[model samples]
Target: MTDIAPPSPSSSAEPAHDRQNLIARQPILDDKRAVFGYELFDRSTAAAAHTAASDAALLFNALSYAGSEALVGRKTVFINCTHESLKGPHLELIHPERVVLKVQTLGEQATPEQIGELLPVFESLRARGFRLAFNQEVLRRAYASWLPQAAYIKLDLLAFKPELAEPLIKFARSYSAAALVAEKVETAEQYERMAALGVRLFQGYWFAQPTVIQAQTIRPSQATIVQLINMVRQQASLTEIEELLKKDPTLSFNLLRFINSSGFGLSCEITSFRHAVMILGLKKLFRWAALLLTTSRNTGSPPAVGQTAVVRGRLMELLAAELLQPEDCDNAFVAGVFSLLDVMLGVSLEQAFESVALPQPVVDAVLHGKGVLAPFLELTRACESADEEAFARCAQALHLSNRQVNWAHLQALAWAENLDQDE
Candidate 1:
């Protein structure tokens, strides 16, 4: 790798269009079956046209808003880069060493003219120490010129015929220095087939799916989470809440630590659970407790998934604050956070909720995706999925403008990032 400095993504001033961006990542593994890196998908920018600005916006948000350390750790991040996006100023914002810019094909049938123009940009990026990745189609004779510049070539298992796999592997190995990556290897059979062909890296759902630990009893921390929720819901007195906190020393410490976190902006330190609860009040305390459940450090689920839940809860609350009662906003927060309890608890949603008491609206939203809080929950999901039509529909149904929704989405992501850091 060359000595070019990583782009200062946080310092870059992004346009208004970039503010609402969110990232989703798929893990990539090496032959030894360890996590090698991740392919970052900019789900928020999914609805936009493939332009340099949009692509740059995605990279900017991944690095700045979601945070590089939290998002990719010390692994490579694969980003799709069009010919135009590769040449854009945004490429200047990324660190080259752990980032692979996958140059997207120009079209279904890219003409020689199109490939010819992008060659120089590819060469320039390569010379600057940026590793280039491409799809298997780049192996065709017409695109042969790009072969030497490639650092990785991905073959989609579902896209190519099984018979052609061997030939493609042979061609890639003999002709280019690029490491071969097998994409969409959704089963053990496909994984073995690709490994037999000397493909060194693999990605798809099969490797990453959560293994549900069925019939497992709840953990002490999780039970505490539920107990706190119930106590807060029943509006327990200060002495009762303090007694509950005293039973779990760790919970008390975490509660104090969280209250004093930078995001809270407390004028003075919150030294005790009672003091913290008094300041936060029941409504805010419940929101904090519900959110704390997702940030449990011991869960099998990825921290990012839990963080996504936190974002959903915060987004729902922020959105609801504009259109609903303060109590309803609290319910919206609960609905959003509890929506992922099944994934977090490794049981069905019904099984997960049996222990906790929730409002009818929150219960309906979490269990049936119906009730007053349902639209807010749906809007939160639409933001995560970048489902533009769903977002518009939900926003319209809730009588919310795009600006309100986008502002809340950005704020929620920023809040989640801060919360992760605090944890």
Candidate 2:
């Protein structure tokens, strides 16, 4: 995970890992958030607690802030680039959305020829599906040449990199690259400088750091668990799931939106909740709903913890379905979910899985990847969580293709998002 665009790794050994943390402020312009994107900024595959590895992870662990209700569908996220990810897989994760990359970070010192070599890489990545951004202090040679290809450019206005700001800003306007971002702006004066320079995207505490809201722990209340168990037991019919969902107006609304999202690629629109329930089946529906319920905060809880679990669980579960044998799909869901148990509830795995009624093997996989479903499930989970070590390890163990894993994940997200949407 050493910073690649369209992030795809060839080796299973190095672990698909990037440990970056970020504190971003959605630069509000015209009372609207500037197009803030998830910028990938750090790396480490350590599972001992993401924050334990580096301050960057701690800072950026909540990069998913864009995923929460606090910023959902509002700001874009720009993840940093990695070498392996330079030409291919990194772009898709943030497609039809905003993402930023440090193009030169793909190399340290570039010869003119090397810069030329990367031009196609940038071209191909953008074509694959990323709305790209550039972050650099020196916008010379290659970057200057590629500036035309960028969607946005970020200059460190606070540090005032004379070498970078002038040329990048000039070229950005000349090409109509979406907007310029003035990062690290501290004082009112700094913001004013960049703002005057036409750098509308500003990131710094002077504006605001994406605040960390303490997330509420949504225990699968006994009532919720009983309902889930009943749903899976097939006692809850298609009509019943639909009705039960309406009881939670928010869930009903999201499910409908998901059913129609581009992720599903549905030729015919999904118009009814009952129809969606029938298509998904009881097992998957309950697993998904219960998981979603568990992730929703009840009070003054940070949305990140829960939202990440929801996205990660849904992502891994869907991918694992394609890779695992029929018998292990639910096990896959459990594995994907528990992978982040430590982070969300801030507890040991043993404590987290203890409350849920899962098969021993599934529990084993979630806890230590100790069962047959563990590797594949963990592999899918790793990619979704962007945990390169787990993904690389699990992928190598299964001798699976990175391409296959990504395709599976994309299909899964698209599927879940659509299936959950009623409208």
Highest lDDT, which number?
1
lDDT of each: 0.69, 0.49
RMSD (Å) per prediction: 19.6, 19.1
lDDT of 2 at 122: 72
The lDDT of model 2 is: 0.49
lDDT score, candidate 1, position 354: 53
- Mark the regions of model 1 whose C-alpha exceeds 4 Å error after superposition: 1-19, 209-423
lDDT tens digits, residue span 1-423, model 2? 112112122232122122122233344332144444434333233443222113222222232221232323334545544434554321232224434444433455767676667677777776766566666533555446767677766676655564556666776677555567777767887766666666656776677655433322323323433354455565555666654443332343344444443332345545345666665555445444433333333333224544444445555655666567744654455455456656754657675444223456666777776877666655665775757877777777777777877777776556444422422
The deviation in Å at residue 100 for candidate 1 is: 0.5
Off by over 4 Å in 2: 1-74, 88-94, 98-102, 105-108, 161-168, 175-178, 210-423
Could you tell me which residue pairs clash in candidate 1? 7-93
Question: Where is model 1 poorest over a 10-residue stretch in terms of lDDT?
Answer: 210-219
Write one digit per residue (lDDT tens) for candidate 1, span 1-423: 122222333222233222344567888999898999888776544455555655665565454334344556667888887677787654543447757998866665888887888889888998878999999988888888889989999998898889999999999888999999998889999999988877889998888742221122222255566678778777789888875664443355345544553224355655445677897777666655544453332333234546677678778889999989987886776677668767765668886555333467877987888888988888888888867899899899989999988998999889766642332
